[model samples]
Target chain A: MASARSDRRISADHIPVKLVIAGPFGVGKTTIVGALSEIEPLNTEEVLTQAGTLVDDLTGVNEKTTTTTAIDFGRLTLPGVVLYLFGAPGQTRFQVLWDELVRGALGVLVLADTRRIDDSFAVLDLVENAGIRYAVAVNHFPDSPQYPPEALRQALDLDPRTPLLVCDARDPASARASLIALVEHIRELVLS
Target chain B: MTSGRQRRRVVPDYMAAARLSVPEHISVERTTLVSIAADADAGGLDPPASHLLALLRDEPLSVYECAAHLGLPYCVVRLLVAGLVGNGTLLTRDPPPSDLPDIEILELVLSGLRAL
Candidate 1:
């Protein structure tokens, strides 16, 4: 594959490809991107005023005077391809921007925390609704109870084909594995 | 509680100042990448727009990246980028790609990750 792509380097005219890394707050979405990014991830913030708060469901979130929506991004450049990994903001209020963010994304990686399993639902729903193929990565947290693969899969009510695996977001190798799973899933979708 | 948007009735000084130079018709996407157009005259642009031209003189950058580099708010940078794009001082690039990665590239990416 590398030999085949040697001649396909992305030009200034070609659109840059992106893959979204999504999950709820405190789920290590940024950590995963940071681990995988070759350069230090860049975080871009947008101010969310009180009017924006009305639509946000901040149940598990810490209190804040003025909400700052942040999206962290990293880039991976190969011989012929330039892929960007963008971490999606976890808050529901930021849903307004999802369409724009996901507009040209290749696929999405939805990180799930076993402790807050339900927290992944909203993001999963958004990805599914966007008609983007996605894979769920259960971020391995020390305190979270461990479950069998089937149990975790059933809890998330995932499609039998959806890839689900446990990964340590802080570890680059583990994070890359999750991304690989997502890319493979995207390939399957395309081929089918 | 008074809403933050409702309470901040007085326009910010910078915004008021920018209103003098930036026209209203210009609009920009949050993620738009802006680069200086070949015909643009940096000296004729507003201070903010001039700074943008300097930043993009070498290469294009997304409006979000510009905001971070300029230490300005995203909305403020968007306005600046929009103004430049509207006046033909700046040009926008192709949007991000939505298609699947090429089979060869996808395999290569997976292999590269494994090798790393």
Candidate 2:
């Protein structure tokens, strides 16, 4: 499957909608891409080393090896649309790559882990600073407290227009709904 | 394959900015343009995305050319293009990439030079 994707990328005819999946470490960016992508996702990842302990937060994700280095690339087809999803790695060290992942994106789906919502503030800030519209999704961890949308909004200080929702990340249907909200939000921004 | 209109871009002005940044006059060349979806992790990408994929399947188009054709605002277009290039969907043989936030660059350069 990976080899097949290699050839397809070279074909000079496949245009992809570039969507960025951003959140803090272990917020399920790679896993979501893997679940939704029609093609075998391409990940540029390296396992975390002991040296990384100084920088990467290892609080909840002691087991995450092979953290994405550059981006996690996936292909998903939505009816007539072919979405090329790029899951941005969570580490602050790789913020250099954020601009690339952002290109051609019409909107953003920012995942926030309720257990570590604090970690997400910076990612949300980056997206907001870029001036492109975005929506927030709370990736519900087993331990993450389920808060009302309004409470989450106040916690995140989200703009009234920003769509705030929750998802399991493991569920395909729920994930799809979140993306649909993003598209709608983009349309609203454009029209306004 | 020729491109087709799926829907109108809200702001062609964004594409215009991206097109102006490029130093080329090609009527058409393949370029990697970005499409942002809201809940990609949850799966809500736009419908026109297929057209976008078909547009970038092969070669890297100049920022200049994409804007003129797509008619999006240049600033918005540039933002998207920069992000896509960052993601490795496109490449430029010249100038490498300059999307490093200007502040970060200044700090890196200043720090390096001072250390030297």
Candidate 3:
């Protein structure tokens, strides 16, 4: 039975590419992943061990050694390559986890909610500090105010060369356009 | 969230089995893709390792997917994957280049996205 089962399996090689979607807690990071992903988004938990010194010590000797954080991700298959979209945990406490997530990523897409545009500051800093290329896509809500590209860029204090665009996280075409813009930006940087 | 925090005090039963030591050089992340080695000998592996191999035999998967499917902690699955990699029982595809991908790959990705 085992041999037969093994025979049915086909061995194929594929290169895995990672792209991260980052934003504040309610910035629709997961929604963007769901929109672009071919499969249902999957959730995985990572066990983070906070340093002993960092934890609060109500009992004097801290015993809280570990905490688990959930990361939602989705996959897309393209020819010989597979694209993985990871929704980064939005809390400030997961700085270490952010480092791991972006270690070898192609680029990051920072989603912003116009109503809470300030919430994206911390995430932008994290992405910049990591030295990875990134773009900002303001997720448009019906009630949120709309501004010109240059005005929004100025408000966010983004670098002139950085790609800034607007998208609707719930719309597949809009989400895909944001991703394409990010890739084009990365390509431009590489060529330059 | 409360249950996850509460469960940390007691080691889960799944982790009580013999611990597999991961090598120093092998780094397992949620995005790291793993596949079974071409000439792997599947005999004599522990149940977890065997199960991991069985899963990978069908198609390559990221470490997170493997952990989720096995119902084990991400850390435990990392060690299991690292151990398998150390013994040449599996192969790993590192994540995309840290800086920027090659122009050709980027173009391919752009075309693929456009086509979709």
Best by lDDT: 3
Query: Which pairs of residues collide in candidate 3?
Result: none
Which residue window of length 10 is worst by lDDT in model 2 chain B?
A: B93-102
Off by over 4 Å in 3: A1-12, A47-69, B1-17
For every prediction, compared with the true complex, DockQ reads 0.25, 0.04, 0.44
* Per-residue alpha-carbon lDDT of candidate 3 for residues A1-192, written as tens digits (9 for 90 to 100): 896444323234556788999987657787898899876777665634345234422231133343224676888776556788999855567898899888888999999878777778888989888899999999997777888888889888999999998999999999999999999999999999
Per-residue lDDT over A11-116 for candidate 1, one digit per residue giving the tens place of the 0 to 100 score: 4343445778888767788788889877567766554544655655555444333333567777665544456777886556577777777877778899988878
- TM-score for each of the candidates: 0.74, 0.57, 0.83
**Rank ordering of all candidates by TM-score, starting from the highest:** 3, 1, 2
Interface RMSD for each candidate model? 6.5, 17.7, 3.6
TM-score of candidate 3 chain B vs. the reference: 0.79
Ranking by DockQ: 3, 1, 2
The fnat scores of all predictions, in order, read: 0.39, 0.04, 0.61
Model 1 Cα lDDT, one tens digit per residue, B60-103: 66666666656566677777677667777888764445565466
Q: Which regions in candidate 1 have their CA more than 4 angstroms from the true location?
A: A1-14, A47-68, B1-31, B38-40, B96-116
Better of 1 and 3 by DockQ: 3
